[model samples]
Target: MLPFQLAEIVNQGKLVSDEIIINLLSRRLEEGEEKGELGFILDGFPRTMRQAEILEGVTNIDLVINLKLREEALVARCLGRRMCSQCGENFNVASIDIEGENGGAPMYLPPLLPPPQCESKLITRADDTEEVVKNRLRVYHDLTEPVEGFYKARQKLLEFNIPGGISESWRKLLEALNIEDSDNMRSAAA
Candidate 1:
């Protein structure tokens, strides 16, 4: 998922099933259409060529948002990721909101056992490592390429260089959708 924030919460830990993805997306689209809204924020769906075809034919894909991040940056960013010991919370030593007990960030503990000292809410999976992240990113890119082309051909794909990273990327995304403030967006979220 380009927006890894949302789909990363799946309990299956990235072992996503096509049936589950399609079913959820279909349901959301159906609910939206019934209400005459016709909108949804699909994160990390349509992962395969077949899945992309299914999405194109099913909801008709009004639009697609793609973020382009450099491979090195993605690798570096992913490799440096450290998850919380208690709650499966993710953090980057290099990114914002870093916290530590001894005035420094603590080591991530996998779900096997809770840290006696940390007491985090969720367990950091074994897969939250550089090797795993790089592998995941590679798989993500492979899956994303065809979908990008598919939507591009339909004039539904929008790509942002997002060279300035997430905050700038989000600002541009909201602006592109003509969403000036949170009020209008609140309706969908609520």
Candidate 2:
């Protein structure tokens, strides 16, 4: 677990050292193994080549999903993100609508609106500012993007392009994972 000080730094869009992340992950994975969990999923991890090398030393990763989105849309979405100060629930106020260019698929992700009570308590993250988001994107392109190639070389990466809002993209994601959507299953049974 990151100390409160390190967590504060992370909240400001700064990355902690690879040693800190690797140590935390090692302990968590060990605990999961002790419990005999079938598997685990990590989001937004192995952000550096060093971290990937360390992970490879410990366990065999079966698959890695790389979700792709346009940088413009990503910036807008990040800027629109909000959290309730009281309940800490997340929401997005941005409604993205980007036109398809050069045969690329058009993208639209509607904002995740909050309830009436949460609306009054909404707070933007410090790191969600346009400047900070852009900086983080720059850092990702410089440091983390290469991790995609690392997984690709191992034949373990699945590039998934998010085509639209949750409903549309989620269905496509289920298809990619070869998993049946529960809603479809229920409708068929009915």
Candidate 3:
């Protein structure tokens, strides 16, 4: 577990030290291996060049999917995020509708409105403020962006632009991965 101090720093939108993350990751990977798991998907790891190098030494990564979103949309979405204090469920109040320019694809993400019961209980996350979200984006550009080039050079990077809301994006993502949409598969997974 991360020390409380370091965890606090992370909650402030700062990147933690590579050594700490690497050690934690190594332990998890070992556990996964011991469980006879064939593969794993890491959502947000290898955020820095050092972490990427270390991960390369430990495993064979087949592909990296980079989901691209407009900065404005990203900021708005982050800031609009809320959690229900009573039930601990997450929701988004941001209704983003951005028109594309210069032949770019338009983006639209409707708000994930909460039920009536949880409406009054919604609370903004401390880190979802504009300042913190912007800081996180800056940190990503400085520290994590390089990892994209590292994977690109290895022909393992797939840059995917998020077209719209969750359903549309999910369909596009499935298509990108050449995964056919099947009711049985979705129900079984659920």
Candidate 4:
């Protein structure tokens, strides 16, 4: 399922059935496999043990990158995220400036300025509220965290709790995956 589809389900404070999630993922995987795709960076699949078991039947997964973050940080991060209504591009509150304080409150000015070539405004997803984010994290810890143990038992989990932001994390990920910065780095990663 697309992020928006999953977001809608999650925003309603409900979970999509594992079977449906697995089926959607399987279809996408099948298509990628047909095209000779060697590796995939699955964002949020196999959240449950059953889903992980089903995945074993599909393809050989070498590594599972688990990014461990504090609950408070996760809540803040989710609350900060905004997306372009037109193109679905993501922007974060940390990167954007918010004017006013106290009761006056929250006037956003994205550092990207005018978002060149795009006419539509960026908006927060309905589910990105603090309460919903906390609930989602609760669900993750209760159900999805077990998947970490599943991979750990198989010696396939590479867990990290890094303090640095995206660039540092991306560098670490490329190192873990053993991907090199060759002339075709962009195409190879794609």
Judge candidate 1 at residue 8 and give its lDDT. 67
What are the per-residue Cα lDDT tens digits for candidate 2 across 58-100? 8889999989888999999999999999999999999999989
Q: TM-score of the candidate numbered 2?
A: 0.93
Pull out the clashing pairs in model 3: none
Local distance difference test scores for all models: 0.63, 0.89, 0.90, 0.73
CA RMSD (A), model 3:
2.4
Residue 186 of model 2 has an lDDT of: 100
* Top candidate, metric lDDT: 3
lDDT tens digits by residue: candidate 3, 1-190: 4488886887899887878788888899899999999999988887889889999998889999999899999999999999999999999999999998898888889999999999999998777889999999998989867899999999999899999999899889989999888974889899
Cα error, candidate 4, residue 150 (Å): 1.1
TM-score of each candidate structure, all chains considered together:
0.63, 0.93, 0.91, 0.74
Location of the lowest summed lDDT over 10 successive residues in candidate 2: 1-10
Looking at candidate 3, what is the lDDT of residue 42? 89
Q: TM-score-based ranking, best first?
A: 2, 3, 4, 1
Ranking by lDDT: 3, 2, 4, 1
Please estimate how well model 4 matches the true structure, expressed as its whole-model Cα lDDT.
Answer: 0.73
Task: Give lDDT tens digits, candidate 4, residues 1-190.
Answer: 6788877787776789877777787898899889998778888777888889988987788888887755555666678777878887877665433444465433332333336554357788888777887887888788877899999999999887643466655676677678875645776878
- Backbone clashes for every candidate come to 7, 0, 0, 0
Model 1 misplaced regions, further than 4 Å? 1-15, 31-38, 85-89, 95-123, 182-190
Model 2, position 33: C-alpha lDDT score:
95
